[model samples]
Target: MGSFLGFSALFYFLLAINMGNLMVSFSQEGLCSAPPILTSADSSDQPRYWKVTNPTLSPAHLQDLPGFTRSVYKRDHALISPESHMFGPLPYWTNTLGAYLITPAMGSHFVMYLAKMQENSKSGIPPRDVERFIFVVHGAVLLTDISGVTHSLNVDSYAYLPPNSTHSLNCDTSSTLIVIEKRYNYLESHIPDLIVSSTDKQPLVVTPGEGYEYRDLLSASLAHDFNIYIMDYKPGQFLNVKEVHYNQHGVLILEGQGIYRLGDSWYPVQAGDAIWMAPFVPQWYAALGTSRTRYLLYKDGNRNPL
Candidate 1:
């Protein structure tokens, strides 16, 4: 009887040890499942979609513009004057999720923090004065227009809204959307033109391709603040010899890899990279590997004489 009791106790002890080891292994695996975050240094050093070949002209030229002068343009272009002037980081809000506002000091620009909607909530966003270009960064959303036009968008999908256009968004699943607002007056001498789909039924979808394909989201003559475009580049394709005539443009890489030539230098670019080019600079790019390259293009300043 004593031997049997001892044997039983040993068996229980071994079982408990095994269970503990299993728990520890499961915990470690769970921790590893989360995605990795990029460090600030890594982001700064990452390659961009456009390389600066010309040592003389680059997006850095905008820094040479006087702050006071830029401020004046900000006031003239934006509907709501920003509380601060220096353009580093903007204010943000948090509720169930995080949201950051990127309000530029000049050229009627503001990007809204991504928002989250409750399961039963009927509306995703409140009515606002500024026109918005909504880009889905994470998850999914169902956008419904006042006329009952419904759009289901996934990550990287976007929608353009004119001023006073009534709409609501619904997130059956969790989502994060970036809303870029144009603050310039449409009645002004230079009203930024909104790029509309040639077909009213569907939003123009930019798929993976070889050559760069762009549809103007907004024109310079229409809005003095900025011009927006949706551009796509297919695998092994590129923009070989193109010159940006007017306005400093910024490229936000949304997908894939490519090599950008800004003058004499070649730079490798991947997803999430951003490159800014000054006016009159000649530049081009080639898609890398088997992946197609895609990006959002923005140009700010006055119309250039072509």
Candidate 2:
């Protein structure tokens, strides 16, 4: 009887610890959004949260455990390498959810996250007051809009969600997504309509000077307070100039390799690397290697500089 009671006590103790961790973890959420994993299976810390939505859902380790998990390193706002990203509790989401997150806390006016979702994963149906932009990097995602309209998005597809709109996302296959969110001046702009489109379908514009090629995923007019760009570079091309401007940017390297000059230093960057720049930080990029380099970039647009 004594031995049995001891075993029972141990079981309850561990269960209590796990439950406590779960409550604290769900308070925040996504990846430290894709640093190479530093810890191996044998040496990993015991998972603090377990995926347990229902009997039908398979289990996975919830990696972002509140304070226990965060960006792999202290992020340098002027420039963040691919290795440093914010990891937090992603509550109300399920099934192999992983994202490298960039939030306002990191000193940007906007939030961006690269979400890696498995089949059966979804973004919870909640009406966030902020506007949202989602770019599909791979796989398929179904977006349920504020008006209950459902849109299907495939590779290179994107969606712009207006402020105060209720929506949710469902992925039927393995997928990767970049979700950018921010507050908008509805009073000034009158809330832009939701836009659903594909990047590949947009006309590519060659910029002045060095002829950098890109497609504006959003309009350049006041109707949009921000813009998303998929800029492409050939192996030997470079940015037209060292851009120093009022507009800040969050950039995710989509393909190939390049050297990025941010602030006063240059960092070698490649696919899956995420970089965030604050207003007035000098920045430039030059593609390297034998292939083209592409990146998804976000910049605040059309708003008064005040």
Best by lDDT: 2
* Candidate 2 residue 215 C-alpha distance from true site, Å: 0.3
For all predictions, the C-alpha RMSD in Å is 14.3, 14.5
- Per-residue lDDT tens digits for candidate 2, residues 148-254, read 99999987889998887788899877777778888875556355888999987899998878847999899877878899999999998998787899997888777
- Cα distance off (Å), candidate 1, residue 127: 9.7
**Cα lDDT for residue 241, candidate 2:** 81
Off by over 4 Å in 2: 1-89, 125-127
lDDT of each: 0.52, 0.72
Question: Among all windows of ten consecutive residues in candidate 1, which has the lowest summed lDDT?
Answer: 49-58
Q: Tens-digit lDDT track for model 1 on 1-306?
A: 999999999999999999897788777766334333333533445333221100111223343555412111122221111221222222232222433323343332454443544353334343455666766656667778767788877765677676666777777655555555655445545433333232123345443533566666544354445556667777877765566565555565666767776655566665544454545556777888675677766665453344
Which residue segments of model 1 deviate by more than 4 Å?
1-129, 144-151, 155-157, 164-167, 188-210, 215-228, 261-266, 276-282, 299-306
Q: Estimated TM-score per prediction?
A: 0.48, 0.72
**What's the CA error at residue 185 for candidate 1, in Å?**
3.2
